[model samples]
Target: MIDHLRDMGLGVDPVCRVLDLSPSTYFARKTRPKSARRLRDEELIPLVTAMWEDSGRTYGARRITRALVRSGRQVARCTVERLMRELGIEGVIRGQRRRTTIPEPAAPRPPGLVNRRFSAERPNQLWLADLTYIRTWTGRVYVAFVLDAYSRRIVG
Candidate 1:
């Protein structure tokens, strides 16, 4: 990475200083042989990458690990998870649903005492709730109102 930055017209000494890496240590480490685990990871990276792309980037660590295991490759889910994090690839999930009128069958039922009659002779007898959206330069803002049935004015 430091070499790449240097190639991009950045000075190596400043880059190394910013990364808190000593120049001698960096070069020495680069010359050292990779560990067995690192060698295995290097071999698996390409396979994991291909599989992730094949799945349209929808495969998370667990799914990727399963695919590798099914192909007779021995690897742990956690290692795959770490690799995915390092590579900055992730599976997308559906966000919270926006439906407001969904019914729940298992929820306790309330009696229909009003029968949809919104009229009221007294101020506090009935109330109506409504939601409206106001558009502004930035975005739409939702406003909710509680109206008194008798006076047709906002109650609460």
Candidate 2:
């Protein structure tokens, strides 16, 4: 940015001052050599890209790190992850999603037995039954109950 401004007749010193940057610091940054980590990253970019492509793009960071280590390459999983993100590549997640309800459109439908009404003249006149499940530490616990509509009480 400073270079662009300098090219457009603005002095580096004045631009640095307006941007709250010291001119000397800006000049030093421009002259400074690339850091060791940056150079290493540049070297590793191609290797990571090749490894990712070799896996048919189905290997994520963890798997990629393992493959690199098996091939005698000392690289961290996080590094591979970062490189993969920079390369804009990711693994394909293979699995079927669990579906609890799969309604059949062609099947005959059951009538609304209660007709959306819950009132009753007596205690046992109207009862509503419902079934549901709850996930617990062990597994899913299915629960079924009957409620007396007139008294608004759980009968079972």
Candidate 3:
């Protein structure tokens, strides 16, 4: 990355300063040998990509790690997750999410007395009442409101 920046006309010292790194440290790291972990990651990148593709691109990190273990390869789930993130691959989530607001079948229900009619011939002839709740820092606050149908204004 530093080399790329340098090629783009940015000086090494300024770039290192912006990255909170010393030029000497950057130079030392640039010449340092690849660590074991980095080498292992390089070797595993292709295997992870192949596994992901073989699964029709529907296996997440946990499943990929399990598959690798089953195949006699020792690898951590976190490592597989990181590799998958770098590869820009992910599993597809299937099925519909469960609804949390299902109405009770046994509960008594109110009759539709207004027959879905909201308009009124005159003010005060018909009023609509609704209950709603809001979440706040303190807690949930419940609010009830009454609306004049003819005027279409909040009465309470």
Output the lDDT of residue 41, model 2.
86
111-138: candidate 2 lDDT, tens digit per residue: 9988999899999999999888887667
Q: By TM-score, how accurate is candidate 2?
A: 0.55
lDDT of 1 at 101: 59
- Using TM-score as the yardstick, the better of models 2 and 3 is 3
Candidate 1: lDDT over CA atoms? 0.86
Could you give candidate 3's per-residue lDDT for residues 4-105 as a string of tens digits?
Answer: 999999999999999999999999998999999999999999988888899998988988899999989999999998988888888878655544358999
What lDDT score goes with residue 81 in model 1?
Answer: 86
In model 3, residue pairs whose N, Cα or C atoms come closer than 3 Å (at least 3 residues apart or on different chains), thus clashing, are: none
Compared with the true structure, the alpha-carbon lDDT of candidate 3 equals 0.90
The per-residue C-alpha lDDT of model 1 at residue 137 equals 64
Off by more than 4 A, model 3: 98-156
Ranking by TM-score: 3, 2, 1
Q: How good is model 3 by TM-score?
A: 0.56
Error of 2 at 151 (Å): 28
Instruction: Please report, as a residue range, the 10-residue window in candidate 2 with the lowest summed lDDT.
Output: 92-101
Q: For candidate 1, write residues 11-98 as lDDT tens digits.
A: 8778889999888887888799999989988998898899899999998888999999999998999989888887889876645534
Q: After superposition, how far is residue 66 of candidate 2 from its true place, in Å?
A: 1.7
How many clashing residue pairs, candidate 3? 0
The number of clashing residue pairs in model 2 is: 0
